[model samples]
Target: MKKYKDFVCVGFAFALSTVSCEAKNDAKIHVSQLGYTPNSDKKAMVVPDGKVDSFYLCDAASGKICYRGKLSPKKYWDLSGEDLQWADFSSYDKSGEYYLSVGGKKSYNFTISSKAYDDLTLWAHKTFYLWRCGIDCTEEFSNFHGQSYAHKAGHPDVNVIVHPSAESAGRKAGSTVKSPGGWYDAGDYGKYTVNSAIALESMLMSAEAFPSFYKNFDMEIPESTNNTVDVLDEAMYNLEWMLTLIDTVDGCVAHKVTTKRFVPMVLPAETNVQRYMIGKSTATNYGFAAIMAKASRLYKNNPDYPDFSEKAMRYAKRAYEWAEKNPGIIFHNPDSIGTGSYTARFPEQFRFWADVELYLATKDKKYIDLTAIDTFQYDVPTWQLPASFALMSLIVGVENNMVDGDLKKKTELHFDKLANLLYDRMEKDPGRFPLFKFEWGSNGGLANAGTILLLQYKKTGDKKYLKAAQDITTYMIGRNATGYCFVTGFGQKSPMFIHDRRSTGDGIAVPVPGLLAGGPTLDAIRDCDTYVYNYDHPKSEYPTREYPARAYNDEICSYSTNEVAINWSAPFLMLLAGINENSK
Candidate 1:
């Protein structure tokens, strides 16, 4: 009899459970016969417990699973202590795995077979479909004019659900209204989040999220997922949408529907020319920079702008240079390191994509140097500082022979390690990763998304890439489930809830109302059924009006705007489309 010591540790996604211990200290363990239970034992490796049913004895290190007699048991052996071969671990390792914890039951499904690749492609397409236009297949109706107009039905900006008081720092929904009713129809701005940017980003990133974007010689790579791919292909789709608003000098975005001959150069979310949603477009234009570079690289094949690459690079370079030059305003000044709080600070941080975009556009070392792989003065792991950028640098560095084999391996490991290190914070913290109060939703999905993209982009290992997106998406959707219905919906203690931006002029008031669930709130509800104290506090009674939800929250709003209802239920509608579709 061999007994393993009781090891205690958390497994993936912080699923806490107990493992069994079987002790046989003096047994001579021979390496040659290192199969699971080489002994011809008849008795089952049973550990009687309160609710114990079946068990398996196996070699811990080699993953050689064995039953009492010969082969592994047909019954799924609930192995403990992270034994890779506890039950169908090989299958789990081989295929695309999905193990979502529902009602505390750890059920898993996988995609396998030689056609496993095809299956994954199909699965990917299905998911893409789900998110592309949601379950309603509303893609055709989701024209730019629809949502931007707000008054129109089938608006793409459907997720904009905000608290009654959150519109003007808990003041009023609009500048004039003393009460909450009549926003979209009243022609009174019903404040929104920066939905246009994300919508555009989604379109661009979608195109290049898969390996098919790059031409592969050895393997017959699949083609793009068509329109679904374009939805996320931040490179082209997002770029084109972005071009629609680039007449601005520095830059201006479109927050609402406008039929005007000429739109003003202002933050799209915050503009006065349009009598649409009154969203704040000011402060921290820097946040969108990272994704801008990412989209630029992903869609390098086609740039809508004349020398789009150069313009993007120029924008990023000029922006940073300006930030650095305006040190006192952007950074520390009177306080010494002085930026006590990130409330108003617009961090001009760079990621690997930033430098790569510049390099891909112009092979200049000067641009390469701008890729800060070193820590910033006010360094912290959460900021992702230079580490996040390092992931991109690894590929560029290897290509440029900047680092040797061993060094490359180290860089690869460090890149992964840093991501893990950041994820560790989120895992340990119970909910969100360590974030700057002023940072808001920026750090929410970034670490996970960054980690996933980093690993996926570095190595064409679809598992890392897919897993990253799925997990983050799960977190996003889960928030909606018990909360708004998407696991990662709005960050609310209750389903009928909203967040207030406390730090600077910027806050959840900006993102929350704008119909985008965003990275932060999605992360908080990724796992649990409710918010931190949701159990204690009863759910807000359906709100005089409530947010849209996934399979849940089918109830129509008596007062809620169509966009808010859409944002509320979009993620849920999107995630469930597969189960509903595949079942059919």
Candidate 2:
């Protein structure tokens, strides 16, 4: 038998199995394989083949019963079509390794400690460093991410062409521009401004929300010696690249820097394709302005980048001015281009975000006046639904007294309403997450939902909010309907074959660690139909998903279900960092 840390790897013949091999005794029992903090809401979901009522939490080594609890009443969840029972053990606060057993079946081992999420937080954050373009992921990183993870630099955008769609009077088609150093937007090698906006917001917000957690949390990237936290350094690498995408002549920002189409699955060094500065739109400017405004505030007065604050503020104002001039001009790829478009239906969200961020950064009443708060429906943050990011900033601004009484009251009420909605969803759902639709990139939604719960915890010091937030962490790690970790290389049954170009093309057995896969999409069959079956079981033998939560494929071709992305990763890192901070 092979061991994956605490989990035991077993054979391939389990019923309803997605992966060929998983944790030995985890067939009916699911948990956060990385375990929980002593005070966290430690609950395990059980889907037994037979009826079981009681559960025992026992010491892993000694086999002594530490806690005995009656299982919660069986609840049928339509998301997975399973009757799940929860083994509530939140009252047991001992710090030690333990496992749960019900009837005759047992779960994988887990630990109860203050540092349960430390490794996860570190691994998740370092993924940003590994995805960086224009710089070699040097062999020195092999010590941290293993030998197979290091690779030569790729996509030096020094000679990038300005596509006809993005052509300005001064910079026409085929004219060269120098734009470099940003993380790949997703499974593909593109770098998109709209997507990077939310991604960087999540990362910077992590640093802003929990300074003590990241103060000494070194990721050991190349910029570790810069006297700033490594998260800021990693974020700055992408920030610098984004700054280059702006048109100095007109102040409009390009939508993305991408090949005409997605390149084949190959390592970055192996690909030789012409990268172009794609079209620009109002969305790009607002997104860019929002990120720059937020960055200006975060990096202000720092010794390492003394002038960056002012520079960012100036560029932000420029972008905002251009956006005001060219309102509602949506971007579309030209006839020749076929990369990810990232088009938004509701562009006003971007304007709202820039207004809220600019207001928070400058404490100007004019910026706040620009936001249409009465009609604007606050949503969970995604690249498209970005008002949530601005809402979070407003909450922070109000708490810090950045605004006066009237605005603060409005911001507080907005947060309370949104947080209450999430709390209501948590109370009703068996999974304890605010997940309804299993859309593409659903994991990112879960992470953002978890952030809202955690922020509410910060606001009210409510243990219920903390418990609900921890449940989301557990669900992502393992305790979900899929019975997989959903991250690339963490749990015993995590994704080994993510639909990432570098990971699939590198000849490495393991995909890059810390990447959160686009988990459990409803479009799995349509996405994976043409791809090769790389798993041990035949396609026909795989379990039939009657519900959304069971819809996932670990094959490399399952882009909708198994691909990784920056927007997904950023919020997850924030969620983990926030959870770790509360644990400490």
Off by over 4 Å in 2: 1-24, 144-148, 531-542
TM-score each candidate.
Answer: 0.42, 0.93
What lDDT tens digits, residue by residue, belong to model 2 across residues 1-584? 11111212223343111222212365678988888898898888899667778777767775656666788888898888889888888777778887887876778888889988887888899989889998888767644444458898899999899998888656788899999889999888999999999899999998988788889998878889889999999999999899898877888888999999888888898887999999988988999999999999999999998989998999999899889999889998788999899987677889988998898898787887623765577657788879888888877666566766777777788889888888788789876658557788989999998988888888889978888889989999888888888887777789987888888777878888889998886765666556553343244322445678878888777788888999999999999988988876
Clash pairs, candidate 2, are none
Candidate 1 per-residue lDDT, tens place, 1-584, comes to 23332212224342222322243321111110111111111111111212322333333332222222122222321111110111212212222222221111222121222332222222222222222210232334222223221111222332223222223333233333111111121111222222322322323322332234322211111214332232233223333333332213434222232212222211223333322222222222332343455445544554333366555655545433433443433311122111112232334343333444445435555644432544333212232232343344454456446555554675556565555554454334322222322122332334324333433334544333333333333333221222221221222221232221110112211222223222222222222233232122233333212211111221111112111222222222222221222111
- Please name the candidate that would achieve the greatest lDDT relative to the true structure: 2
Q: Could you tell me which 10 consecutive residues in candidate 1 have the lowest summed lDDT? A: 27-36
Error of 1 at 388 (Å): 1.9
Q: Which whole-number lDDT from 0 to 100 does residue 490 have in model 1?
A: 26
Q: What is the lDDT of residue 321 in candidate 1?
A: 42
